[model samples]
Target: MEPCPECGASMDPRSCDELFHALLALDHSRQAPWGPLHGVSVSCFLLQHPSRLPADDGAMAWALLHTYLEGGLDEVNQLVGQARRDNSHRVKGGPLRVVRDAPLPHRDASRSRFSVTIQDVAVDGTFPSSAFTERVKAWAAATVDAWSCGT
Candidate 1:
């Protein structure tokens, strides 16, 4: 396994269930501005790692899901721009593509807060068909639960 770019610790690619549970266990509130970016950076790193692709499809989905859930569209855009500019060695298919293709969460006009669901966005074509997956959908559902609980 290769060392994570955000943290020098070695990381192995995780399955969708593993990634979902791990993220759920984290105190994302403490992760703040940089924590979300760190996840994106790590996914990008795994995508570029010579060892293998590192199951980065799930990783990228997780990162993008959380970024949109927590920081909304602006933060997602910032991370996407960073990944595009910083990871020069990236190929055509990578986390950057996921970030670029994924839909940005929007605030519902009727609701004061951004209450839009992944399913709604996906059905409406805001989220590209390719980027919307079971894993990403699960993450978005979990995010909704977390937000409702005020955690």
Candidate 2:
């Protein structure tokens, strides 16, 4: 199987479909303990699969990733809520205005993107809550690390 060109992660089903399903299961299942991790999971997935979004949405994804890397879900969620509440920036049904508000990084075209892949997130296995939490954190850290060099 071919790996993702952006992140270099190979999946059983191509083009990140399996990864989409995995994130859906984690975020949508009320009975699942992974709900709180939804933000971080989405951030990691979007950052890796930058093709999933347009440029502005991509900026929002990067913003979320930085927030998650800084303070986990709590920090990111707080920012999201604040974004929703700020009516001036709010769209009737569009992306949060925080995209415009956030301090976007300067990307160097000379530098290649993303050294970290979503491969470390482990979509197949059933992990206990604590283990999964640590795994997600590691994934976020690694992704952030890979992008730390002014990417």
Candidate 3:
């Protein structure tokens, strides 16, 4: 196995192929909404280029994830705003707020690798422990499987 230049994640030659297929699956599947995994996929695609690594993979991943989440929040906020304009009484929450802890980026230069953990997520000031968590996990698992199976 070789280390990915950008994130330093150890990857076999097949890893890139796997990543490519994963991206394709995400593109095709309606079940996979635009979110963290999309960000990760884009980052991986950019960083895993054979020619050069664009930036630290781990940092890029977190940055993309943050961007994706923020974009989602913006969409939700827009929807809520639209709802308020349409019918003031129909909207339940004034606005949905999403909050999450900063991702912790860990890297080992010697191994040319990096990883991150998303600590928590909250929607409307409440932890949706199951739904949100499960979505992320399922997306990640699917991504891994997509690549591992060489599909």
Which candidate has the highest lDDT of all?
2
Give the 10-residue window scoring lowest on summed lDDT in candidate 1.
105-114
Candidate 2 structure quality by residue, lDDT tens digits, 79-110? 77776675444446664566434454444322
Model 3 C-alpha lDDT per residue in residues 1-151, reported as the tens digit of each score: 6654543444443344454554455445534343434444444444334233334433433344444345553543444454346455565665422233334233322222223212111222222334654544433333233322332
Q: After superposition, how far is residue 76 of candidate 1 from its true place, in Å?
A: 0.3
TM-scores for candidates 1 onward, in order? 0.29, 0.72, 0.33
List candidate 1 segments past 4 Å from native.
1-54, 90-139, 142-151
Candidate 1 per-residue C-alpha lDDT over 3-121 given as tens digits, one digit per residue, 9 for 90 to 100: 44321323344332233334333324435333333344333223223133344434454456567666764777786777666566745544444544433222121212223222232
Instruction: Score candidate 1 by lDDT.
Output: 0.40
Clashing pairs in 2: none
Structural RMSD, model 2 = 3.8
Candidate 1 vs 2: which has more lDDT: 2
